[model samples]
Target: MTVTDSATTALSQGWCALSLLHGRIETHIERALQGGHDLSVREYSLLDVLSRQHSGVGGHLRMQQVAESVVLSQSATTRLVSRLEDRGLLNRYICDTDRRGIYTDVSEAGLALLAAARPTNDAALREALDEAARDPKLAPLVAAVENTHHDGRA
Candidate 1:
């Protein structure tokens, strides 16, 4: 293969490995969360994110921000929020100052569920990463993931 072609092939392979790693991890976590807490990965993620909000300035997240954090479209995030709300795991309120803005927070039940599910998620993630690390094609990606900081500074 030509130099350019070789480079493209390598990049594509790297992308595929990353995608596979993410899929496996998510699936593992999904099973664990669902079986243990009746929560999907997305639902657990949404609850976890909303649980971190505070009343201070810049503490509340907007719908778009929540969607971005959960890696879902805004509409999907809203629907997820609604589901949780129906389950008594979340509460949505219209912003007092800005009638156009809406805010969501985890209810007491959601916090309790999140607390219980956190360990399940973490263990599933660790198991998935360990399994992925055993695969030659995914080892490097797994290492990269494990070494990365939350701020993206490795």
Candidate 2:
């Protein structure tokens, strides 16, 4: 027998719905960034975070810090940074205070790429959000997602 929305179930519909929504948004952002800018959403996020590190004198972040900020595993973050470095988009260096710690700062090229891609990325997100808001059924889901982000729980 097949179960439908009217049937009793053990699964949480809310969680499943949110997970699907997240997947769709992720795909949308990934495609928009990659197709238009030749950059992945993860790469854009990394560059964006590095560019915002004004608290650091040289606008750098430790590799660990970058991993945490970008929600990438340490090894994955290292590889991604290496890829960006190879593209001349960023520079990796050893921290002055901690010889074993590595840090990365966005290069001029990285900043320019991010600047160029920002509009495309922003437009895609705005369009997705606007569409969600227009759908009465999806509006609450979008609101919940926005609230989590604003509350720093995202």
Candidate 3:
């Protein structure tokens, strides 16, 4: 095959593999949610991000930062945060330095919920990891995908 044809073939296969992986992860997250977590995958991701930021940054993250991490539009993030705030899972505060900026932090109840869900989340992750480990060739591909940052960082 010509170089161009070979490249196209490789690209197609890579896309297929990525789609399959995405579907599998979504399935795992769905299973966890249905098993009594009471939180969707996106909500869990938001909580996780807030928890990490709070622990590292001494308790607050800008709306933009959280939106980027969760792959949501700014408006969508605002709505999601509002829902979480209404549910007592998070607290939003106006930034004194920048009136236009807002910050979000996990609430105590949110932390408790996250703690309760940790075991299930860990179990799902472990299963995925185990499957990857068994497939020597797939392990590196998975790692590379995980480590990839799509935020314009080189």
Candidate 4:
């Protein structure tokens, strides 16, 4: 179905608002996580994904898998992994069967950091949503975001 020009305009405006809201929320969470736990949002996300994917073969995942899981480019993910490894937050190993494959697992320290950062990030998100929802026009979008999150968690 074809959308009218006005509908298209509204859609574009909605997208812009959503993008701005996303940036604000991300910034809030990034600052909170970094200030409270010395972890960047992306780093925390990588650690969280590693913890979730930990299983078998020293409880690690291939580098490619981690890259895909974190939605980061392979090079970016590699750099993050290196940083984590240097910080003793995670460890890397060569896959036994695949000579070319490298695997990574969260260290005891990484898990601990992730545990500490989770609440801080969550609280930041909640606060951001609350602030945004104060605007009547944004309440519906906030609800939609909350519902989407709630549904994802379920």
- TM-score against truth, every candidate: 0.95, 0.80, 0.78, 0.86
Q: Tell me the lDDT of model 3 at 11.
A: 91
lDDT of 2 at 123: 87
TM-score-superior candidate, 2 or 4: 4
User: Cα miss at 37, model 2 (Å)?
Assistant: 0.7
lDDT per residue, candidate 2, 1-154, as tens digits?
4676435343465666667676767778899999998999899999999899864475667777889999999999999999999999998778777799777889999999999999998888867776766766567888987789899995
Q: Work out candidate 4's RMSD over C-alphas.
A: 2.8
Among the numbered candidates, top lDDT falls to 1
Clashing pairs in 4: none
Please give the lDDT score at residue 116 for candidate 4.
Answer: 87
Give model 4's TM-score versus the native structure: 0.86
The runs of at least 3 residues in candidate 4 whose Cα sits more than 4 Å from the true structure, single-residue gaps closed, are 1-3, 56-60, 152-154
Each model's Cα RMSD: 1.6, 4.3, 4.6, 2.8
Per-residue lDDT for 1-154 in model 1, tens only? 8999999999999889888899999999999999999999999999999999999999999999999999999999999999999999999999988999989889889999999999999999999999999999999888887778545885
75 Cα displacement, candidate 1 (Å)? 0.7
The models' CA-based lDDT, in order, is 0.94, 0.84, 0.79, 0.86
Clashing pairs in 2: none
lDDT of 3 by residue, 51-143 (tens): 887434445677777889899997898899889899999987777767997778889999999988878887886577557646654666677
lDDT of 2: 0.84
